[model samples]
Structure formats: C-alpha cells, structure tokens
Target chain A: MSSEDLETPKEKGSTGEKQASEAPKPVLSSGSFLLVDYTIRIKETGELVDTTSEKEAREAGIYDASKLYKPRLAIIGKGMLLKAIEDELVTMSVGESKTFEISPEKAFGQRDPTKVKVYPIRKFKDVEAPLVVGARVNINGKEGIIRSIGSGRVQVDFNPYLAGKTLVCNVTIKKIITDDKEKVQQILHNRLPDVDIQKFTIELAPPEVVITLPEEAYLLPNLQIAKRLIAKEIQENIQGIERVKVIELYTKQT
Target chain B: MSSEDLETPKEKGSTGEKQASEAPKPVLSSGSFLLVDYTIRIKETGELVDTTSEKEAREAGIYDASKLYKPRLAIIGKGMLLKAIEDELVTMSVGESKTFEISPEKAFGQRDPTKVKVYPIRKFKDVEAPLVVGARVNINGKEGIIRSIGSGRVQVDFNPYLAGKTLVCNVTIKKIITDDKEKVQQILHNRLPDVDIQKFTIELAPPEVVITLPEEAYLLPNLQIAKRLIAKEIQENIQGIERVKVIELYTKQT
Candidate 1:
C-alpha cells in the first residue's frame, strides 16, 4: 500500500484498475476437490434435513457436540452431491454462498404405489419382539414398515422415508484443497467421524501417504473396512496418492 | 448275468477293447476347481504341519470331531496351494495320490536377520499381562514374537513361525467338482464349517444360483462376509453362475 501511494503522489489516473487486471482469481471447475459447508432442507416445509455448519445447527435446536461441524470435502462430478448441486458448483468461486431450490424429481424420486404392500400378521409372530404399527420390519431380506394391522393382516410401505420431497440447499465453498495430505485426511475423517481429526498427522511423499492414527481409533470395530473405504476415497479423489500406510504407535506409560 | 458275459460269441474278440476306447477320462487343468484331502509335513523332522483328512488328523493326535472333514475346494493356479503343489496338480487326475517335496524357498521364504530386532525391556511393561519368551506381541501394527529376554533387552523376531522350513505334502484329489450346484454347496460349506452341507439346497438356473440357508446358519456372526466370500468364490470358479441368492427362512415355533 505504501509503495503505490508514494509512487502516485496523490494523483493516480488508473492505478487501481491496472492492479486488478494483473491477477485473476481462481474458480472451481469439474473434478476439483473442495471443502464446503452446506445446509439442506425441505423446500415446502423449511425443515432442516442436514447441515455442516454449527451455528445453523444450534439455531435449529439440533446441535450435538459429538458430531463434528467442519468443512466437508466434495469432489465435483462425483455424484457425491445432487446432480443439480454439482452442476451449479462449476460456476462457483471460493467464499461464495448460494441458495438453490431443487425440485422433487431432482431430489428423491416420486413415491410409487407398488412400494406399499400388505402382509400376513403371522410374519411378525416369529420375531422375538412385539411389532408396532410404525416400526420397520425386514421380511425376506426386504425392509418395510408396518403401516396398519387388522384382522390377521398387516399393511407395509417399502418406499424411502424421504421420497416425493423437494429440497432447499444453502451452500458455501470454504476452501479448495490442492494439497494431497489434507485431501487424504479429509477422506479418512469422512469414514471415521467419531475419531478426532486433529489427532491425525499426515506425511506426504509423492504416491505415498502415511497416516498416524490416534490411540482412540485403534479398537474401533470394522477397522479394516474403514481402512479399505478410506484408501478407495483417497485413490479416487487425490492424484499421486497411490500407497497409504496407516501407523499406530504405542508408547510406554509414564 | 453280466452284459459282457451275455455278449454274442462273434463280437467277443474286440468288444471289450472297443468299449474302453469309446469314453474319455477327465483330467485336472489349471482353472479346474477341485475337492481334495491333503496332509502336509516337514520333511526333515516329520512334524505334521497341516492336514484336511480325518484319518490323518486322528493319527497325528490333532483330530477334533467338531471340525468338518469334507473335501476342500482348491482352484488350480489361484495360489490357494503352494506354487510347487499347484504346478504338480495339473498333471494329476481324480482319485490319484502323490507325495511331493517343497523347498523352503518355494514355500515360506527364508528367514532374514534384519527382521529380528532388540528393544528395551521397558517397552513391554505397559502390556496388561506378563510377557513370556515365546508369546506373540503386536508392536506398531506388525506381529512378532518375543524370542529372548536378557540383560534388560528383549529380542523380537518378526519372521513367520513356519519360515525357512521345507514342506512335504501328501495330496489326493478326491473329486473335481464339475457341477454348479455341488460347487456352490462346497463353497458355502467352506465358509460355514459348522453347518451341515446337506442342509443347503441349491437351484441353478444358468447365471443365477439360489441357496437356502438352514436355521442353524442364520445366526452366524459375520453372515454378510460369508455370503460375499461365497459369491466371490462362485463367480471366480463357476463360469456361468453370476448371481447368488442366500435365503434364510424363519417360521413360528410350536
């Protein structure tokens, strides 16, 4: 600021215009790995379905301390988000916030009548527990809920809970992650949300990332599944991250 | 009384020879899925290493009646067996038995000295139980055993227990499974050894095989993993069976 002010000597014709034209800002594109915070709701009722922002969560009376509220990693054109949201992200720049309305068709598909069926009351007798009218039941490997039961017959609906609902989404692109280490950490956090993300430390050498897991994450059930899913996400999202080594160090107690 | 005894006298000269040449016998190939019973030992010490035959197991004082003693499915060239054994099986036929020697290099590779390391004794003090000389310990995600403890230093050897040992294997190909139904049942039996194989009823309509799981196998731990492994084995072994449906039926108790 001082250099420009001293050179102009209080009389600048087009100095501000020239500086703006010298550098261009970055824009998000397809295949870009992004960190964003979003809040999704039902368009008709304005009911909050999901959100990544803690402030919005508290305002809606759905705040949970156990759930981490942080910027999420999203890969464009990966179908991770709705197709409408992915299509809109291409024209977005960093730090921009937008609200978009998604129709029912673009959101969950329309509910079908065939998804609702009737079953015999005897089917629930084998279950060890009593069946309620609205409780979900798995029959013959298919999941459905009991809608009504009368006269030795039961009615069940197999449609998705959110089918035939329009969505309203408010999103903000926080930052774009160009570093491989951060990308790998974000993907690992996505898979293991219960673990504190700050405890992880990542070392990056091209084509190899070594992640040091915390002591709390050692005894997690299905640890191999988590490792496999994290590896898949890292390989799919981050370039040059072909090999992953998860290290767990045990130290002597003092 | 017999067909050969009742044949006409005019065709007696070449009838027996002609019948033998009309049918061809089956031989195992690289991709053939076989059910075999084998016993493996260390050639130098005559120590029993492994066996799949009940008689051999009983003779070696390792028989467990709870363990299933049926033939095991081994896919040739799939690294299910040692490379030496796999190479030798291509020339084998059904009902044939062979004893072959496998050198240490061809089996588990020779032991390396660099894999053995000496750590301070205090490193093991935090372990909940007392440390023994030969107890296996997991150190930083790598499994190793305590080889020796002397002068406040503990020596841990990371080599496999069977490393640097030559193996002598006696194998007999009981049957080569060519039927899709039998192949599916064998794979299921391999996954769920406690359940009776006869309880599994398989219906094979090309590209789809339906297996009905018995009541005993319904509550098994990790049922999804068993199903996935069975599906993978069927797909990898049987060419035409693509879909696998495992049905578990539950009925009301009297």
Candidate 2:
C-alpha cells in the first residue's frame, strides 16, 4: 500500500481508489547511461522510420552503407530516445523489452495545412520538366515533397514527412553504462562513427585527458573538427576535466 | 693580394691564375639562413622574371595580392633558393651586394626545340573558340603557353618561359635569421603566409616542441593538412626535436 493512501485516507475517498493503491513504483535513475536497441515505425502507414538493427533496416530497404548500425546510448533524461519513450523507460528495468504507441501530440506533432503551398514552376530552377509528383526538393533550405506540377504552377507540401504520425516504438534495454572511461569512448564513437574507437588509447588524468588517436584517424575527412568536437563533448559531459589533449603521433613509414 | 703568391707558387703556374687567387676567398657558411632581396630579368629581351620587392612587382604589372612579397629566406645549401645564386652569395659577405649573370645551363635548362609540339584543338577540352594566343594552358599536368590556334590545330610551347635566356640578377643580402625559435616561426610563416606567425606561442623542451596555434589558424583552408605538414617540417629540420605537438586550444566564448 502507498504511504499517502494509508497515512492520509480521505473520509470521502471511494473504495475502488483505496483498493488500487498497491505498492510504490520502481523508477530508473535519471542520467543513467543506457544502451538500447530500438526500431521506430509509423503506426498508420507501418513505415519504418528508424532501426538500430542492420537486418531490420535491410529488410525494410532503408539500409545505408555509411551508417553504423549498433545499439544507441541514451541517457535517461537526455530525451534523445524520444521523450515519451524515455518517460516510459524510467519505470522499466534492464533486460526488459517493450512495444508502445506514442501519439502525434508527443511525437512529431500534427501536420499544419498552411505549410502546403503553391509556387511558380520557374521557382524550382534545378528541377527538370515532366517532374515526378512525389519527388523531394529543398526550396530555400526547407525540405518538401512535390504534390503536383500543372500549368506552370507547382504545389509543394513543406510539413515534415513524419508529422501527424503515431509512432510504434520497439525498444530493448540492453545494459546501463557505469564505467566512466567507457562512457567517454562511447561519446567518441558517436562523433567518429566510422573509426574504431577501441584502437584509441585514452589516458584520463583527473583535470586532464590525453587521447592518443589511431593512425587511421590522421587523414579522415573533417578529422580535426571531429577531434575538437570529441574533446568538447568529453569535457562538457565527463566531469573533472579541465583539458583534453588529443595527440596523434606520426611514426615514420618505411 | 694573393696569399698563394706570397707563400708557395709553383714555377709552372701562369701569372694570371696566381693574381686571381687573392686572399683565400671568403665563403658564407653552408646551411646558413639568409634573407635576400632580389630582382631577376631576362638578359636578351629584358623581360622581368621575378623580384622580392612589392613596388617592383607592381611596376612590372604582375603583382598578385595572394603572394607575400618580401625578402626570401634561403638556406645556403638548400636548392630552393637558386643554386647559382647561393654559389654567388657565398663569395659575397653581409653588407655587400652583387649583380651577376646566370646562363641557361645553370638557370633553367636551355629550351629544347623538340619540347614544342602541335596538337589537335580538341585535345584542349576546356578551351573556347577564338582563343587568346599566348594564354597559358595546362595539358595533361604539363603547363604550356599557347602560340597559335587554327584549322583544328593548336601550337603549344611547353618550354619554361625563362629557358634559353641568360638571367641578369640584382640582389642584396638583408639579414640572416640567427635565433633558433624565430627560425621555427619563420618556417611556419613560410607555410602559412596569410596568418601572422608571431601570434603563435611555442614552448621548446629538448626532443619535444609544443606549438600553440592562434585562433586565426583554426579554420583555414586545409588547416588539418597544414598542421600535419608543419609538425612534419619541424620534426624533420629542427634540431633536438623528437616530437612536435601542434596544439590548438579552444575556449568557450562568453
């Protein structure tokens, strides 16, 4: 029985309310780093929005070779794994899996009809004639799908493709990350998804971190920017670090 | 003035040869870093080739704002600062200047008649019709100046423009960089000419040189490649350096 139910029983409280007051619920700690494998689908069209499983992605014909398919690390209160879903996970434990529905109100929000508009065909300078009706376009940095092109007028729908959709999320809580070093490595992996973070040697001296990058990381595209970003994320998230030294030692090639 | 004349003169030696061997000719030390201002002209046509002075470049109508025009650093033995010029500089001391002639053999090699070739106009995929003769063209990684274009044929001269001509060189020795730290910074300035090298901070511990890059260097074009190149240059040339740490520290802006 709940402490509030037992201690402060209202004189006019219904018997049904008193009967359902069983036990205090278990809640997962906020900011707990969780490793989760998840798949999100739009409830109405059954369209696959995202999946961490390579097999699932391939089956749905949504696989991208450039993307790394792996379990995502979601901090409990960070809201990266859908806020409503994270709220649901707060009451669940590791080793448990759940499938739940999120309404449009909590998901991408209802589609606004005003976002659909018409423009002159000349406005799309890059689009060729005999245009595909469903082709996607970027008009002034806003992504939209073409609805129709008739008589020199082109109709465009600028609402987010996922708007107004109810999401069916299937998620499994694999484990909670507790080690500080592993957390930093996971952060690095998130930034440099292509490179193997395990090869990098990270020495954490309190108030300083020395990250020795692997040889493969030397000429990777945007590697310098990524290194700076990795350092920034590590310093901001991982406490007690005043400096991050990302060192890349170039050995003589024979 | 000949030391050899006063000391040991062979009985068979010519008087002219003995008179020229005056006072054991003083030579500049090899590998000495020197700042030299020079102007080069083709002796035949008197066409200006190169000059270190900005005013001279402007007067010649070939001034490019992209280039940094100042006294150039010439390491005595390094082939970069013209071998013939270095040989001449060795005979002349500081506070002295000399005007000398370099033949085609010692300067750019004599222009070969076989190097000039006629090609079909179609070979130049990027050239437009009614092309400007004497315009520079790069064909198959080799640079050439166009001589004529007509009847589906274009005549290209691939010889170095300065080839086959004797060069009249007017030069002055400005200063020799002596400080070891300034030498490193000067090397850096040679690599990154647009940014001021004085703003960068360098900490030298034997076998390890730490270079703190300025904020202006953070987003330069090919900055990552440039940083790696800088580290490689410092390690290769600088003495007692086993490691080069080019550190760029980013601070949060308020």
Candidate 3:
C-alpha cells in the first residue's frame, strides 16, 4: 500500500494530499538538517511503546538547543532513513508533520512462536517464590527476556529480533539527518565502539576499490567477520563500485 | 544490594524478608496449586511492562477457567524460572502474593552499548519530515524507536530494557506442574506448539542424557532454523541432562 494509506485515524487532514503534493521537494543538501518532536503509538492497539520529551533529551546529554529543538534533518538517495518512512519523508517538505502506520512487515515482524520455549524450573534458583504461568523472567547468559511462566515448565521466548519477528512501528518524522559519509561513520562508530573500523582500510582504486583488515579481527572470537562481510555489504549497498577486494593482513598484536 | 535495600519507593509491604517471615509457607505437593495475578513494574519509574490480566491471557489463547480466573500453579527448579527470581520463589507457599524488587543486574542485566548504532537518514524513505531529537525510529531492521536526531546525524540509542533500572514484579503462585521431564516438555510444547519435541530425541546416557536432532533440521531456512534452534534449546535446558548430544541425523525428515 502507498505511504499515505498507512495513516492512523488521528493523522487524517483535510488537505493532506494537496499539501503533500504542493510541498517543495526537500533539498537534502550536504549539511542541512531538521529537528522534530514526535510520539509513537502502536497502530493495532494504540499502546505507547515509548515517547521522548524535551526533559528526557536533556537528561540524555543532548544539550545543543538548535539541534535539540528542531533537530529533524533529511538526506535523499543516501540510506540515512528507514526505507518505509523515508518513502514518506520524500513526499514532504520542511515544517511538515504527519503520523503514519506501518504494518508488522514494515515495522517489527510478527511474533515467532518457535522463539518461545519451556525450560526446567531449576534454572530459577535466584527466585524465592513459587513459579506461575504468565510470569516474565530474564534468560540467563543471553540477551533475552522471558514472556511467560508455566507449570514445572518455564517458557523463555527470545526477542523476535533474536528469533526474527516482523514488527509494526508507528512513527512520526520529526526531522532528518544530512548525508555525510564521514559524519555518519563517526556516528555509527561512536554508537558501535566494539566495531573496529580502524581495522579496515579503504582505498580508491579507480573503478574498483579495495579494502583490507587485520587478520587478528577474524581470529577474535565472536568478531563479525568484518572485512569480507563488510565488502559484500558495501557492494550491495553502494553503486558504482565494480568490485571489492578484502585483504587480510597478519598482525602480531596478540 | 540486599533484597530489603533494593526495594524501591513503590514497594507495597515491608521488605521481602519481613513478608516471608510473616506468612506461613503453604504445603505444596503434586496437584496442590496456587493462583496469583500480578503486574511487573519498573521500580524506579513505576512503569508497567508486563501484566497477567485475564483479558491478555484470553487473547493469548489460554482458555482454561483456572487460567482465566485464578490459575493455581507450583514452582519447580531453575530452568523453569529466572535464577534470581526462582531463588526467591522457593521460600514462598500457595495462595501468597508478593511484590519484590530485582536489581537491573538480576532483572534485565546491564545494558550493552554494542547493540546501539546510528544509521543514515536515507534508509528511511517513507519519512517525510526531518527526524526530531528523541523521536523513536527503527534502525538497521531493529526497533531502536529513536533516541536523538542531529545534523548529518541521527543518534539512535537502543536500551528498551532500561539499563540499571530496578524492576518490581508481583507474582502469584498458581498451580505448579509436575517435575517430570516428559510432562514438563508436554506442557511447554502444548503451550507453544511451534516447539518440536520429537526433533530433539532424548538419549539415555546415564547421568548425562543427550538430545540429538536430525541433520536435515539445520538446512531449513530462517523460520525452520528458528524451530530447530528451539528444539536444540530443550536439551541444553532439561535439568537432569548434564551432557547433550546434538546429532545431525541425515535419515530424518524435519
């Protein structure tokens, strides 16, 4: 379905279609940015999963007023947005705000029953009370939260993302970020510090580009095989790169 | 922190120790059941994350009268419970309900920054307006629900399970199923039909029984992979099975 068709009951406007059509095609320049404030409600149940207030932003370390107040920015052609929502953003201009609904296919996928399982009651040594059904517990040594508790059986369901759930997220476009590969990389690296981008060196070999990484990265247990994996990722993600070479170098750091 | 010290402001009664000492431990046996209905809340924020409402239980396909009204159940050992909470359940008896506080370490554990990342705005095509700071957005196919948006930058942090926040869960001991392994598996599989118990064959290797799966199970795609993963999980979870043999049987059709 079209993006406009996904609006919630509260999102309807008299001239929404006209305004969207007449609105200037936002120019996503190199440094232009926008800031917006919005809340999220589940489309099916309208339950609020979460929302951010100005107070929360300040507490979260966002100090810059300009960036914090009107911080919605957009970048076109660059994958700087959610494909589902970005499709909507491209249809609006500055100062335009709209609430949209996304299906489970677009948001978080549907819940997977396979991801849920029953465990022996003994695993809950730390609990002092009796076990019951519908009790939510924490999975030991894993990034999972239990959804239910049963008889001599304890059911632990991994996050569908861990098990793969098609989620439907209703969101508002507050603003968009600009398109700056370096800035984006810095943001990504800053957010994911465990990922050693320094290990991978990128070089422009004209039409064909080559990337190299330290062999130690591969040897590191649980490391996400970056060089080859990233090479394939970059190729699939970016156009004009004819080929990518992943070279592994032996390092004596260990 | 001690359980008493961990009690947040919302805790209803005296600390867990005080309540445990006052209530007589109900004599629980096979068939002796308890019914409890409670809500799990975040102690610090007093936010309700999960609840065992009759409405929700009915919606989840649990139609038994006991499950609908007062589901009396027993608490077994570890695998059936969270180590921290299960440790607490052992001290309680039937018909008793308590609201206890669990530290983040015991609840959801510490938040890992490695899971956070900031992606380019271009990835969100349907989003028209700029991303606002603190607006929730989906990131890299994960529900980050946006934390912050900035120039050429969208700072999307993920920690849905609030890190370091104390959790308050109200538990009622309903009926505890028998501790028999086969019986437990039947209950779990019955509750969650997607879990394949047959795929996971139990091997009677004394003191260290093993559970094996057919080789074809692994070759199945994402959904099937998820199913097999759940099956293999049964082996690692069974209480008495110290050693598990995950054999890949080529003859079996998964």
Candidate 4:
C-alpha cells in the first residue's frame, strides 16, 4: 500500500472511486480510532433517532448547538459506541459504508408489561416537570415515561424509551487515527465525554504523556479517578508510555 | 546573630534561656510566616477557651484527635491570625512571649440584651443539637446560643459567644519561615485551612512554581476558583513567579 492511501481522509480528496474499485481495505481491529458518520432512524415511522451529519440533524429537527457535528470518534471494541456497531466495525475497513437493522432485543430491550405502574398524582409533588402524559419522570430512582395522567392518577412506563422498537443505522467510516498520541487522547476524551478532546492538550515524550486539562474540568466529579483511569488506559493500550503526567492549569479567570 | 536562630522550632531545642538573655530579637514585619503557640482563656473564670499545645488542650478536656497539635501558622498582617493578634504581631519580635487581655468591645463585641429573644420550643425541632441551655444553634443562617429551655419556651441569645466577657490570650512566636517559596505556600495554606499544606507538593522553578495537589481535593467545592486564587496570590506575592502550574494525580485507588 502506498503512503498516499494511508493519508487522512481530508487530505486524500476524491479517493472514493479508487477505494471502491482498486484499493484493498485494511483489516481494522480492537482499539482502532475510526472517525465515522452515522444516521440512526426508527424504520417503522421513519423518525430520525440521531445523526452525526449536520445536514441530516438539521433536517430532522435534532440539531444542537452544543454538539460536535463532524465525524464522530468510535473506538473499536472500546464501547465508545453501541455493541452492535462496534461488532460490525471490527469486520469493516476505512472508507466503508454499511446499513444494518438492530432488533429491539439488541437495542434497549423489549418492553415488559410488568414495568408499567400507576401512582396517585400526589406522589409526583416533588417532580419539577408538569404532570402531563408523555413527560418523562423518575420516581424513587426508577426512570419512567408518563403514559397517562387522568382521574387524579398517573400511569408510568418504566421501559427504556426506545424499547420494543427496531432501529435502522447507516454508518460510514471516514478516517482512522494512526498517530499513537492522538489515539491515546481520543480515549481520554471519551472518558471526559462532555469536554472537547482538542482542549485536552496532550504531548508525547517517549515514556511520559503530558496532558494539560482545561480549567473547566478542575471541578468535575471523580476527576481524579478519571485522570488515573485515563493514565492507566493509555499505558495499557499505547506502547512505551510509562508515565502520564496530567496538568490542570488554573488561569487568572478560573 | 547565629544561623541556629533561623532554624525551625523543632531543631531549636533548649534555646529559651540563651534567647531570653543574650540574643537581641530580630525585628518581625507583615506577611511573615510565624509558627505561634497560643492559649486563650476567659479571664474572669479561668476557663480554657482554646490552646495550641497538646498538653494544655488535654488538661483542659478539649483534646481533639483530628486536630494537629502543633504551633499554629500566623501570617503577619494576614487574616489567618486574629486582627487584634495580627496588630500585635507586627511590633513583636521572634522568640518573645506575651500575655494580653482583650475586652468584650475589642473581642466579639459587648453583649446586647436586645439580641436575646424568646421562641417556642417547636422552633428548634429542625436543629440537630439538643435545645439545651448554652447550646449553639443556627436558625435561618443566624447563629445564636440557646440560653434557656423551659416551660415550652426557648430563650436564644443571638449575640456573639465571647460578648460581655474579657479573654486572656498568651502567645509565643516559635519560628518564622523566611524562604520565599515557603512564604507563598504558607499563604496558600492559609486559604486552604482544612488540609495540611504539606500535602500540596510545591516546587519552585524560577519563573514557574509547579504544585501537585492531593487527589482528595479534586471534588472540593469551588476548587477551580480556589486554584485560580492560589495561582494569582502566589504570583502577586512572590517575585519571579511568572507562572503557577498545578497538577492533580489520581492513583489506582482513586
């Protein structure tokens, strides 16, 4: 394989035709960092479940300003994605596209009749959301959907929101991260999913991986545990990294 | 002046006689980190109020296991020491001991009879401590001392505890830290009073002072603000500290 074939997807423009006809796909494996674009939908009602494509998300009325719109990072066999998608990813290659259907059993699980329960309206006094049908609520730690609210009573379904429904998922692998440092950072970023990975400035120096965390993450719950876990994971997954030095800079503005 | 005079209090064994008779005490000034031993008592009753010495605390039946029985840190002109004591510290030299009395007006302020109020015993149900006389309680954010509890009524005195009494304060300056980095650290330590400053591993590197925080401090409230303040204080107080880098390590046990 030529080095040109190994170039990042952005730089290797219009390689699609050559990739489809001439080039052989690389055998992707566990811990591989794949930048993938995916669009999920409910096959029965053709409703958009989720999408990495900004256009599709905007069209489906699920566009969020806070969300990253580019190709999503999916680490193979690391559970950065659904088990079903990860399983398919291990068999596929870079630049490959696949469409699959996940049954209810493999998704959020089939809905159970026993999961539904009814409680008096007074029981929801502490709930901040209005007592209306279809509003989600958590009563005594059990997450439920308010199925009906009438006769001074509320019926809640404890089943997961997507239970009993099959989902159609279309995915395209855009690029595979090859650099060792970038790969390690993506894993740490996955652990701190809320913060952008780019903000976690990481530098590799043979035995030490020095990472300076963003100031905002200084107060994150279990941040210490997360840092240790990030270090441990990097040492275990990436070769030659004996130490992971995590620096938290408290700027003037905090 | 002997170099031995600059040694830590732990190493200055039996220098009391020599210090008293021979050595002209070095002048002290503001922002000096002094390790001071102190004992406070109610002048009228001779009741032990507080003491730094373990022997005195044990004798007074106020020994606490969680407390570090050592000379307390008193940063001159800093609020870490009481304003009255700080006012005295600037004039007092090292290795000197003094006993002084502060009146109610200079202490917690004179007792106000109007500050006392009578309330029904039911008002104290939410108070965890028993509503006994002399018990301290805080209601609706206002701290008050329970003066009497009888006949279905409770008399609460909202005046300061030390009000209407004079306190006898005895203090001895044990040692004064003179190292620039140590001085900055003591200042930071004063801000984070709950945790020992020793755990905050600090290394001075010319323009940069790198501090490694203990993992336990990761989840502290307003930790980000605290860190920023620490860095800002160090830079502003210590010369040549152009940068302050803080590191937090999370171990396997988290």
Model 4: pairs clashing at backbone N, Cα or C within 3 Å: none
TM-score: the better of candidates 2 and 4: 2
Off by over 4 Å in 1: A1-254, B1-26, B55-66, B127-133, B252-254
Among all windows of 10 consecutive residues in model 3 chain B, the one with the lowest summed lDDT is B245-254
TM-score for the first chain in candidate 2 comes to 0.82
Lowest lDDT 10-residue stretch of candidate 3 chain A: A245-254
* Each prediction's TM-score versus the true structure: 0.46, 0.77, 0.29, 0.76
| Superior by lDDT: candidate 2 or candidate 3 | 2
lDDT string for model 4 (B144-253, tens) is 99998889999999998789989899998777777877876776675566676778888998678888877667656666677777787777656677778987653332
User: TM-score: which is higher, 2 or 3?
Assistant: 2
State candidate 2's TM-score: 0.77
**Which pairs of residues clash in candidate 1, taking residues 3 or more apart in a chain or in different chains?**
none
- lDDT values of the candidates? 0.74, 0.76, 0.47, 0.78
Greater-TM-score candidate between 1 and 4: 4
Winner by DockQ: 4
- Among all windows of ten consecutive residues in candidate 2 chain A, which has the lowest summed lDDT? A1-10
Candidate 1 on B66-127: residue-level lDDT in tens?
77766677888777788788777767766678999898898988988899999998988766
